[model samples]
Target: MSFASYHDNIELGDTVILYLSPTELEAITIKRGGVERNKFGDFPHANMIGKPFGSKIYAMNKRSWIMALYPTPELWTRALPHRTQIIYSTDISLVAMYLNLKPGSVVIESGTGSASLSHAIIRTVAPTGHLHTFEYHEQRAQLARQDFEAHGLSHLVTVRCRDACKEGFGLERVADAVFLDLPSPWDAVESATRALKGPGAKLCSFSPCLEQVQKTCTRLRALGYQDIITYVGLIRHLSFSHTKMQNFVIRPNPKGTNSNKRTAEQSEATDGDAQSVQPSAKRENIEAEDEETQASETAVVGNPGVKWAPIEFATEFMTGRPAPSVRHARPHGIFDLCDTPMLSYCFRGDGLIVQNDQ
Candidate 1:
């Protein structure tokens, strides 16, 4: 069957926690039967499956309602069921985007925590693609395996208890994407680089600090990886309120509505004064100034032939940032002489040859 067809058949369930009294489960009668008994209460599995995800499954007798159809990541994070610290949805989404992960691509993930990210990866790379996740911790690995089996994704996921970085990526073949979420990602960079398909292969490292990013980027560059960029994702949930909106619109705060009004008044006053003067001459002068500025802005900044060189740098090498003095190291190798150098010298593939002096 096609990947799309497989995704359609998968029964994605919403996890709900029911807080019930002692008498609820006994009072309610249901069919496709099994009651998941927790410390708080017992939930009837039969009554939940057919209901829409996020629908509240109310146990009237027990005075409880189960929150249904929440996202899998959310459910896994809250109810780990087993002991494990899981990767949150924020990291998962970023990893998926930066790595360009999709169906049919082979992915290698290490330190599978609670299998939250593993489930997300499986969902993304289904049918044609497969994920080979390694976890050195025995307990975490077992729990992750169980979670995958429960989701019926065991066929697509290969869980192994091995030190992925130390033993090298266990695959006989290279992977399209490699995701490193371990504590020390720098240690695994060499192995990950070897497993990646050089230039086009995507590698992502998840760290909570800039220090880790600095170390990882340094290693990646030394290993001949190009175009390496690092950034953090911050997701802030703003509370939507009509009262706050009205206050922002009507309140005369200096930084908000008051400043906006002052700017508008100043613009109107300037327009009136300009109109009272020689309007035609002023307009012509302003147009001329704008044209001059546009011409200067559009001037060919660098050699039009070379592809990788920054355009503006050639015209005035020291305009924005000082252009590095291209000192020929060994007749072929180009070296830069600058405190803060630009990466224009490292040009590969077919592109316009951007000269330092045009």
Candidate 2:
């Protein structure tokens, strides 16, 4: 059967360890249908190739047993030979979240570091997106490449042996996310920005010291990026048991009693409409009175008790009166009086007298 088919048929319990060749001891390749010699004993792949992946294979002669399949980050961390320090799962999970890395996001990671982080990124951005990782150390890069091939992720990742900081190599197109795991991540900020798509692109760095974070933050700001925040991850496991459930005897306090009372009162208040009617009515009456008083105080005519001034008089003074004076000053006379004089003729004993004024 093909190696790919062989890997597929192996069930959970089958024992398998990727064996390293003599020349490439750093690289671990899947050893099937062959005799694997170790200090403990000789493990024949013929016995294990047909079994399930997790099958417990015990060599009674050697008195050893190993469970198989691809190694998880935790198992790989403990087992993988490392030239540089590997990133822990805690940091890896946080980085993934902050970057918003999905299956199709092209990710650029620096310093493969036993390929622990690389392996995780591959799993996260699988099938669709590709991960291009750079490692300065040749041996480390080679080991990471081998691990990728063994895990069937060789097509998904490209491990380049180049000094990413000095040369800034292997950073081609704009990546959706960039993860820097080097000792001096600030040195790679320029390259990271060049590799990112735009302001939407995300870059995260892992540093153990506060000084490193300060330096990285400065570089990030200089690159015109916003919403930069640095925080440490802390995970604490709580011990829970039926016997240890919180009891009133353990935490006796007035605060707890008050909280319980408040909750009960709120629940009762929401149960029926009768208890809510009085409060709602009182609220409406208070609001209505406040509005009425405000309206009275702002009336157009003066209110002696409430101290309101006439709106018309205020508008006249503020806007200034019209320049042309009226013929009649009184309000009624201005409308009733006519500007032209009235002519009248009267006969005084056969003589005619005409008067222009009326």
Candidate 3:
């Protein structure tokens, strides 16, 4: 299968992702007679020539190896330069699908930060479509242009170094969709309306704050845009691991009284009778008990040394039954390790959509 835009055998100047490891990847272009040197080893460019993508090449020392794979949009986004905050795939995928992008869609984008998403857009709107992207920052615009040319996508994209907020975009009723990722997106609402080809042309703006979304929505509706709706898009990754169950014998509370405590003779008698019950009867009893509990903050075992301490547990603790727990580093910790990102981030994707009146 095709990785990104690459479909033929690897040759000169084809960008590839050097998969050193799962987390360790380096984006590079395959150049003849060129060599890629890393701490692991030196990878020769000529060696990759004529080799189909997805080829694995081990270093001469055999101690290190890397996989040469196609640069899909997902991989490109992850490997792009973090010059500024770029849209994550959670929002990108939604917008692309929501806009109904295909092989002939025309798109307008403002504030092309890092042009990370632009690549995906071009990929979706290529072979006949066009993307007119406006970037306020001259340096950023120039860099984006370079990126398009480098990826051989310049024919499909037009990067303009003009401010869509103050000066307004230079297009008029020629865009199938408009995407704004600006700090003050409200200021460009009028411009977006003017850029749309007709009623039903999709308009989307990405903002980082609720205040921005509210302001943008107001501007969009006031500018005669119909059917405005807003939403925050989010993406979550779930993982599963083997959990080792640690049996914790229940312990008596310090303030236990006769009403709450069960006598050993009584408990033994009750247990004997419970064991005699049918399996279905036991399952029903256990399920009934699970329905009554909520959260947990402490785990006290029968051992005297183990005092009543808050036991960090997942939301599954509501079952009241202690199951084998697979410890997690916490969502906050995961966010932190991924560059101290916000856990509940709502990329201004779903926030507002102006109904295209046909």
Candidate 4:
């Protein structure tokens, strides 16, 4: 199966993606007598041959079935065997976009582990461009080359076995963009600079540690590379469900209470002498107004018989539930850096101060 091109029906020796569920997908090569055994049942390869690329094939038991999907870069990422720690699609997209990859673009990639990002890059630059990928390990390089040949993408990518940090990419002024994934990327900054076409060419480095990024950026800046920045890609999950909350009702205060109070104040003022009654009447009127203001301000809904209000949040149309999470590294520490001589941290009312003696 050519990942760069699409076909209608499955052919022998073609890689097929068996989509068992949203979270479960497996890749298999179609052979004449090969059978895929899973919890569902045995899915014979003979039954899958000649079927449509996306046709659903039932197991031998005929109770459960799986979708026969054509292989794509995204699906391949999920289904590819993990030869090493490979880059995921989230980071792949960021790298591709930042490197400004396009058709006819020549790219240099180091340490092509598992060929996950390599497939995606090949698809983006197929039919016109080429990818020069280098791997330090010979076995990995050979396996990646075989996979590329099987996918009919050998013309679009070239796999080489070389440690880029010590040997460098060998080619100069040939790459439009370069990607580095190594233990010490700073050691290859000079070599990457020599490989770029000229000014405006881009370079991207993937490092898990902040110190690595720091050293890489320093080397890049010293080599005259501009606009050096580091970013972390994070995915947030929003929970959607129905929540029950209390409902309030507002009712008018009874008029009888206010009227009875006013009447008594008026009677008391009338019993006093006229001179004293004038001031008393004014004071009584002010007091009545104040009481009314206080009552209006304090009015609240205290009814316990209110029906529950069902508050529904935004619903996920794709999964019909919470968003699916991608594999990622969890943070090891909770801390923030401030521009000061000492470090200060406030976590849930606990304050910590560490002096930066360096």
TM-score leader: 4
Predicted model with the maximum lDDT: 4
Pairs with backbone N, CA or C atoms under 3 Å apart (clashes), candidate 1: 54-68, 54-69, 305-352, 305-353, 306-352, 306-353, 306-354, 307-352
> Per-residue error at 23 for model 3, in Å?
2.3
Candidate 2 per-residue lDDT, tens place, 1-358, comes to 1112235445323324443332222113435545656554665666666666556555537577554444555445545676777776787789889999888889998988788788778778776888889999888788878666766678888888988788885455569999988878989989888888876889898898999999999998998878999979887865634332121011111111111222333455665653654666555654554465454334322334322222232122223542122221111111122221111111123231112222
Task: List lDDT for all candidates, in order.
Answer: 0.59, 0.60, 0.69, 0.78
Candidate 3 clashes between residue pairs 3 or more apart in a chain or in different chains: 200-356, 229-352, 230-351, 230-352, 231-350, 231-351
Kindly indicate the candidate among 1 and 4 with the higher TM-score.
Answer: 4
* lDDT for each residue of candidate 4 in 1-358, tens digit (9 for 90 to 100): 6899998999999999999998899999999899999989999999999999999999999999999999999999999999999988899999999999999999999989999999999999887999999999999999999999999999999999999999999999999999999999999999999999999999999999999999999998998877888989876766655434346222222231222233454556554443454566666665665576455423322224534211110011112453232121111223353332111221222222222223
Looking at candidate 4, the ten consecutive residues that score lowest on lDDT are 309-318
Better of 3 and 4 by TM-score: 4
Please provide the root mean square deviation of candidate 4 (C-alpha atoms, Å): 17.1
How big is the positional error of residue 198 in model 4, measured in Å on the Cα after superposition?
A: 0.5
Query: lDDT tens string, model 3, 9-57?
Result: 7878788888887777888887767888988898888888888889997
In candidate 2, stretches whose alpha carbon ends up further than 4 angstroms from where it belongs are: 1-8, 11-43, 61-65, 170-173, 237-358
TM-score-superior candidate, 1 or 3: 3
What local lDDT score does residue 47 receive in model 2, on the 0 to 100 scale?
Answer: 61
Weakest 10 consecutive residues, lDDT, candidate 3?
A: 335-344
